[model samples]
Target: MSVSSVSVDLYSEKQLQQLVEEISLRFFDKPFRHRAFFNRRLRTTGGRYHLQSHDIDFNPKVLEKHGMEELIGVVKHELCHYHLHLEKRGYQHKDRDFKELLKQTGGSRYVQPLTERKVSYHYYQCQDCGGMIRRQRRVNVSRYVCGSCRGRLVQVTKND
Candidate 1:
């Protein structure tokens, strides 16, 4: 049996702006007067709201990898920051108002991972303490020592 892959068309920047505007008006009952566009440079974050410019920059990987629903959730999350900040209310993630607004709008608190980390970890063992340490890069045994017991470290193995 063969599985056919369906191609999904992503939205352009102009369409993204329009979508943001519509979501803002419908959910928040407020108009998004600033610009919204896809930002290809965004790596881990789903979307970012500019404090000074009030513009929203979205990671295209959200829609590309997740789909339209996840992208909308990201838009809502950014809009929470946008609207609250503009209103002179609490806009930061830790603020009560921001949390309330985010919950009411059904915004996503965290986005799915866009890409997997391909980093390999180097495992080390402390001679004195028998503690294990994991590092992405190799640590020099001559220079670095274990903090717990000041023991010399020996490389155990490398794992992906």
Candidate 2:
């Protein structure tokens, strides 16, 4: 399904659980007996499958940024780990069974890397002392003087 059509903004933990269960049955031909929920704390990972608890944790960012298709791929990838581990098959990323199952189910091999937010800093340099200064917000060069030598601060670069 298209990411835009999934309406993930309103999705809750219950819906996430149901989606995982549905995907498990549809793609793996097995039932997902464990729980699945959105983990807002997940930063870089798309999803994580707990080996001990058998529960799945999904990064909400996946749905927010990548959409439903990417979320489903992540679900499938976790499911591959879930089912394979339970069945005593190779479940690690380096395992043959894991690779084959991931390929067969069309699961994402890796989480799509999140775009890092860049902070633009205004750069200033002292005209007399040559001291460098960086500020998040623009500073009035005429009013603000260099901290080191109290010299006139000149705008060196707008952003970096």
Candidate 3:
């Protein structure tokens, strides 16, 4: 397989944006002004809002492991801080503005934990004959491939 192989997770970028916008309106009664993007480097954090650029960063792993509902909760949590601070209200976790907004909007008080991670599959290939395989998880396909000519690579049996 060439380095060009691209694997896209289930969620699309547009979907994330829609979720952010929806949460902003539903919770703060205000629009989210900055962009939201997945930060691949993010590991422990679910989401972060930059005070300087006013942009929102989210860990894609949060959505990949969890579901949409969990992602929405994270967005709501971030928006609580974003809106309150922009309004010149205390937005820190200790501040009254932050506490009030969180309760009133029913946003999460703390970051939710991501779901237990499952190993991701990006397809597979055989070394001997350039045979390609697809799988949901890594497999020792070496013992399982083209029975004829022993052309190592076997197309993954699963639709995924």
lDDT of 3 by residue, 61-155 (tens): 77677655566667877887788778888988899878887888776665556555665555655557665655565566656665444656644
Models 1 onward score TM values of: 0.80, 0.70, 0.62
The collision pairs in model 1 are none
Clashes of each: 0, 0, 1
The C-alpha stretches of model 2 lying farther than 4 A from their native spots are 1-5, 115-160
Position 73, candidate 3: lDDT? 68
- Candidate order (TM-score): 1, 2, 3
The per-residue C-alpha lDDT of model 3 at residue 33 equals: 78
Q: Per-residue lDDT of 37-72 in model 2, one digit per residue for the tens? A: 988899999999999999999998888888888888
Ten-residue stretch with the least lDDT total in model 3: 1-10
Q: For every candidate structure, what is the RMSD over all alpha carbons to the true structure, in angstroms? A: 5.8, 6.6, 14.8
Give the alpha carbon lDDT tens digit for every residue of 1-37 in model 1: 1111222458788778878988898899999999999
Residue 122 error for model 1, in Å?
Answer: 1.6
lDDT of 1: 0.90
Q: Which candidate wins on lDDT?
A: 1
Show the lowest summed lDDT stretch of 10 residues, model 2.
Answer: 1-10
